[model samples]
Target: AQSVTQLDSHVSVSEGTPVLLRCNYSSSYSPSLFWYVQHPNKGLQLLLKYTSAATLVKGINGFEAEFKKSETSFHLTKPSAHMSDAAEYFCVVSARAGGGNKLTFGTGTQLKVEL
Candidate 1:
């Protein structure tokens, strides 16, 4: 079984400041890790994915994560925050190779931005 734990359930930031969200995972097989963002009344948009090949992965909206096998962690980071970046973030895991693209979502980390 594979499981993902998002360290923060909420993050608050001032506009233009950097954003960071922490996540950790446990997987039996080689895992595909993804960070997704959701705006109000919208579906999730893929932020990035970490395949076994790359340690550092970049995604849309200036989000990025590094797959650290030694730490069992995949943490999302952004250099700046915008009001538009205020949304719900999810740490997702899939055992697609073993179980298919069925996704298991984290509880969610709500990002709030101040002007």
Candidate 2:
């Protein structure tokens, strides 16, 4: 079984400041971790992903995350925040299923950026 836990339900930051969102995961096998952002009434967009190739992975919009197998963690971070960054973020975990893969999504972290 695989599961993901988002440490925070909401995170607020001022524009130009840094942003951080924490996540923890559990899996019996090596799991693929991903961060996705969803804006108001918009489709979900992939922010970053860890597919067992690199421990530290970078993604679009100046976002990055490091996979810590020992700690069972994959936390997302950004050097600077933007107003457009305000959205709901999800930490997802995927592992091998019967014949394919199963994806489990975190509850979500809503980001609010203020000027």
Candidate 3:
């Protein structure tokens, strides 16, 4: 079985500052890691993915995450934040070799932006 836990339910950030969101996972076998972002009432966009290829993966909007096997962590980070970055983020987990890619989504982390 595979599961993910988002460290926070919500995060507040000032515009132009850095952003950090923590996550942890547990899986019986190798898993695929993904970060997805969603704007208010909008469809989700894939920020990045770790497909058992790279430990450190980069994604759109200057966001990135490092997959750590030892600690079972994959935390998202960005050097700076933008007002546009204020949205909900989800840490996802999936089986790498599954027929249906049933992605398990984190509850969600709402990022608040402050001027």
Candidate 4:
């Protein structure tokens, strides 16, 4: 079984500051981790993904995450925050099941960017 936990329920940052969002996961096998963002009344967008390729994965919008197997963590970070970056972020974990794959999502973390 695979599961994900988002450590923060809400994260607030001033514009041009750094942003960090923590995530932890547990999986029986090597899991596929992803960070997704959702805007108001918009569908989820893939921010980044880790499929066991590289330790450091870069995504859109100046965001990146490092997959640390020893720490069981995949935390998202941005060099500078922007008002347009305010959105709900979700940490997702997926693993192969008996016949198919199953995905587990963590509780969403809302990011608020203040001008």
Candidate 5:
């Protein structure tokens, strides 16, 4: 039981505004969650990850996510959105077994930053 669902198909924010992308997941056991961003011509980059350490995990580019086990959610948030932040965001769940990692990716949330 490893799956991730992005609650929104698209999220728009004005430049210098706050950004929020909702995400939910289900796992039979403790799961490692991550937020990834893909630009128009770039590969997927890791934004943040949760690995049973800190509840509030911080990552690059003013992005952070809180692993809420009680709620089964890992939502991505940023204090302000930048023009460079306009891209596709995905929430991923990783399960490690047999010396390998199994990853499940969310559909994606298209973030359109308005000027």
Candidate 6:
């Protein structure tokens, strides 16, 4: 199975500033990675994903991530921070190589945006 680690438990940014949520992955094979966001009192929504195709994957709401093989990292970033972007972000990896094609999620990073 693949393991994912979110580097930060919480990240705070001012409005209009850049946002970054770091994630590192470990797997025996090239596994699929995804980023999901959950707003306050809302369900989780897909943000972005990387599946061995292009290293740079663009997702919804102006969010994007670059998969770096050498570094084993897939960090999410946005050029500007919005108040509505405050949410919990999860990093997920596929466990297909291990047996079943299930998605395993790691700890989430809570983002806070201030005025």
Using Cα atoms with residue i matched to residue i, what is each candidate's TM-score against the true structure?
A: 0.93, 0.96, 0.95, 0.96, 0.97, 0.94
lDDT of 4 at 95: 86
Query: What CA RMSD would you report for each candidate?
Result: 1.4, 0.8, 1.3, 0.9, 0.8, 1.5
Give lDDT tens digits, candidate 4, residues 5-110: 9999999999999999999999999989999999999999999999999999999999999999999999999999999999999999998878997889999999
Where in model 6 is the C-alpha error above 4 Å? 97-100
Those runs of model 2 whose alpha carbons end farther than 4 Å from true positions after fitting are: none
lDDT of 3: 0.93
lDDT of all predictions: 0.89, 0.97, 0.93, 0.96, 0.95, 0.93
Error of 3 at 45 (Å): 0.5
Tens-digit lDDT string for candidate 2 (22-72): 999999888999999999999999999999998999999999999999999
| Predicted candidate 3 versus true structure: per-residue lDDT over 30-64, tens digit per residue | 88999999998999999999989989999999999
Q: Best candidate per lDDT, number? A: 2
Worst 10 residues of 2 by lDDT: 94-103
- Superposed by TM-score, candidate 4 places the C-alpha of residue 17 at a distance from the truth, in angstroms, of 0.4
In candidate 2, which residue pairs get closer than 3 Å at backbone N, Cα or C atoms, i.e. clash?
none
Give candidate 3's TM-score.
0.95
lDDT for position 103 in model 4: 83
Report the alpha-carbon TM-score of model 4 versus the true structure. Answer: 0.96
